[model samples]
Target chain A: MTEMAHALRVQNLSKSFNDNSVLRGISLDVATHEVVCLIGASGSGKSTLLRCINLLEPVNAGRIWLGDEEITRAGIDEDRVRQRIGIVFQAFNLFPHMTVLRNITLGPREALGLSRSEADERARGLLERFGLSEKSDDYPDRLSGGQQQRVAIVRALAMDPELILLDEVTSALDPELIAEVLNLIRELAGRGMTMVIATHEMSFARDIADRVCFLDEGVIAEAGPPDQIFTAPSHPRTQRFLQRIIAAGRM
Target chain B: MGDTKRSAGRGSRLLGNRAVLVSTTSTILFFIAVAVVVALAPGSDIVGERFLNWVHLKQSLLGTATAPSVAEAFLLNVRMFMIAEAIILVLALVIALVRGVPGPVFFPFRAVAVVYTDIFRGVPLILVLYMIGFGVPGLGLGYVSTRSDITYGIIALVLVYSAYVAEVYRAGIDSVHQSQTAAARSLGLSRWQSMRFVVLPQAVRRVIPPLLNDFIGLQKDTALVSVLGSIEAARAAQIYGAEQFNYSAYVVAALLFVLVTIPLARFTDHLIARDRRRREAGGAAPGALGTAAGAPHDVPGAIG
Candidate 1:
């Protein structure tokens, strides 16, 4: 709650794609090293909020603070802000034309102005930690769904970002492969990495998140600790949504 | 099941043999029939003397004392094509990138790119050649205007061909998904950096076959520079025909042009075939992405 401890702050963020508003009047705050998860259905604006926070998608109305700086202010350097925040997408979105090492090293070498050897050493270390050193020379398409997603995470980690945003990182993986990616996220959480994850995995969210926000329509309908949000939900829509998830055996 | 599979394979092989035999025999017979008809035509002897004279063909290729050899003159066409093609590749990509620049601040640059492509592509290459070839020299700007006609020809080819090539590059740039750009930008790379490293490499790879197609057209259009009396292959052939009153030199020139284009055409076909194979193979093939330039690339995690 203290301003000095805040890692990210979004105040009344709104975004629209033409006539369809994706995120409306959404605000949330994450403390340093704390993990927050955004849980919602298909059109619940979780992905939009993450994208807006990363400045990949410009918000229609809002202000966002990264650490001490107001990132949404006019004339702010988007590249510089993005350098401190890493994002892993649902579809991986690895550069198909680059090998895993190159994909991981491209941002540090190009944006951070790290020398080739420095970037390579950093990338290799992350790859080793993630069990992807063997696939460093291989392209993304050559890897399995799980391996590709893991490489994507390593790509974000290569920048040594202060905060990371993960948007449904397991949504595009096979059911069997989903566990590997979730385990990696759990490891990052244990390491005290500040993370904002938007996910459909009910159990993973419940286990790892310090706080959970249930988004409906374009706003966060409810926010609380995962146990309260999941087991003793207060809102009818939250109850209905959890009922659907449990009935589908997704929890 | 094994016996049936062996028999099916043998059956297919037999059918393939019969198809090859029948087609080969029919092709031979068709060529023979055409040759017989042409040889028996009433004006065959005169036509052969005028256009198919072996002696004149040899003379034109080797060159007489008065006229430059068609082969030597073709070196000029080769020079012009090489120079123009190189300039077109770089210039067209710049124009394409400029047109793709976002924000109202780049409006003027994008407008210039649009008008450039429109004016150049809309005008005929021949007209462009004439205007630049004659028009630039007419300005009489001292040393600048006094440059050789071939220089003007090369410039004209670059201008016209770049417009078409720019559109080809733009199509390629558009074909790359927005997600790729988003991923790059999110990694803290600037928009220009994202374009240079991620988008341009992929775009250029995907459009190689089409870029080669444009190059082939440019190679042939090098002949149009002869309108300025540059004495390239076509012009040399024209001179030989006029002096000797034999059209065989034109045949020699045509053959030379085809000779240069055939290898490039075959190379383009090879690239297209390789791209199709990679796309159909689910992009897991060795050396598929980046090595041979990514083709379609499995649509990014689409397999799952």
Candidate 2:
């Protein structure tokens, strides 16, 4: 892809938790309006990479660029950078004290400095679009796991972010409830939103992602379209990992 | 199956009735036995005449020509408690927030908060009362130091209780999950904004029971201010006891203290019970994160 089309760029990213290294000198480039899927087993640095990109966890050594802005440099306003990107976690961390409308409006009103009426209008529109307008006054604990996850997605979308990160968004839901969240992600993908999703749903990744990167032991061992990676993988580790997934009937 | 279920329910109700009967009999028998033993004691009449004299109780509550009314003097204790409680709430929250500030930039502020809590919490409340009550006035700072001894007593109370209340607030803040802060920060709220909007509300709600517990102690400690010779209820009772050579006035003062605090204690219990029920119903979550709003049961006057 051309330099101007790059939505996010990371160079030699490395992270560690004290003595245990997670991401080891990883490089990634995501293009505009592109949906990239990060697939890997647990503890393979998938979540860490997403947290690093959002500046939630300070990187030990790395440089991240968001649309030509060097966000990792000293004196960069991390809070302003975070405002431009949205992240949805597995645990739907909606402020339980707040109603759905308040949770969605907080970021917009606080960070963007929108008037209360303006924030409320924008939040209501997103809630209606996500089929949650009726539940806007309810607390998150009152919602089902699936409905809460959808509200979380709507919460992120209310920010009107340039890029969104999804970290195992469906992993916490019941199997029957996973479809609603997956459908919402599919809708976002259809609308051409730039996203980097770390997920374990093999089939959903195959359907929604334009490019799939299989992370192994802290690095992307294989990268390609879903058809090539799933049906005919080049790397031995990729083949082995897919075989296990197939044996487990997850693919 | 329906017959079995009905019989089982009847059996439980019968057992409950039998339990109530047995408990009532034992409680009545225990109280009767204690009364007989006390009536047979050698000094029972003397004790009763000295502490439970009905005429003296009446006179002590209403005050006499020579002594101030214990009831009226109690208003000073109530006033001191209310002012000190309000100041403690705000000052303690500030101290807690200062200690919670992160990064090296706030190191000095955090250090001051630490030293403050440590000093006040470590010192005895009565000693603090003595020091500020006597020492500040002893400084002779003109008009500033020459204020009423009641003012010094209130300051002492605020200094000591805020330390305790600050720890309670810190515990509540720590009980909030780190994920909550992460979510707020990821939404681009500054650290202070996240704390102000997201953290403090939840923290304050979670610690209300403990905060009330501290306040109950504060209510009783209002009597400590009498050490400054402010003539509050306890001091009034002391003067009456010395004049009449009877301790019945002390009982009157104790009853007055209990009259104010019992309602507050019940209110705190109700808050705790409601919070527990909400948690059990919410199942794993702390439930609506606790609204710091109106209490279901109105606790008479003089308390929020």
Local accuracy by lDDT, each model: 0.93, 0.90
DockQ score for model 1 = 0.58
lDDT, residue B252, model 1: 97
**Clash-forming residue pairs, model 1:** none
**lDDT of model number 2:** 0.90
lDDT of 2 by residue, A20-110 (tens): 9999987889998999999988998999999999999999997999998999999999999989999999999988888889999999999
DockQ, every prediction = 0.58, 0.49
For candidate 1, write residues B1-304 as lDDT tens digits.
Answer: 7876779878899899999999999999999999999999999999999999999999999899998899999999999999999999999999999999989999999999999999999999899988988888899999878989899999999999999999999999999999999999999999999999999988998999999999999999999999988999999999999999999999999999999999999999998988887777677653535365335553343455
**Per-residue accuracy of model 2 over B1-304 as CA lDDT, tens digit each:** 7876779878899899999999999999999999999999999999999999999999999999998889999999999999999999999999999999889999999999999999999999889988988898889899878989899999999999999999999999999999999999888888988998889888998899999999999999999998888999999999999999998999999999999999999999998998887775543333445534334332111110
Scored against the true structure, residue A130 in model 2 reaches a CA lDDT of 87
Native contact fraction (fnat) of model 1: 0.75
TM-score of 2: 0.94
TM-score of model 1 (CA atoms): 0.95
Q: What's the TM for chain B in candidate 1?
A: 0.91
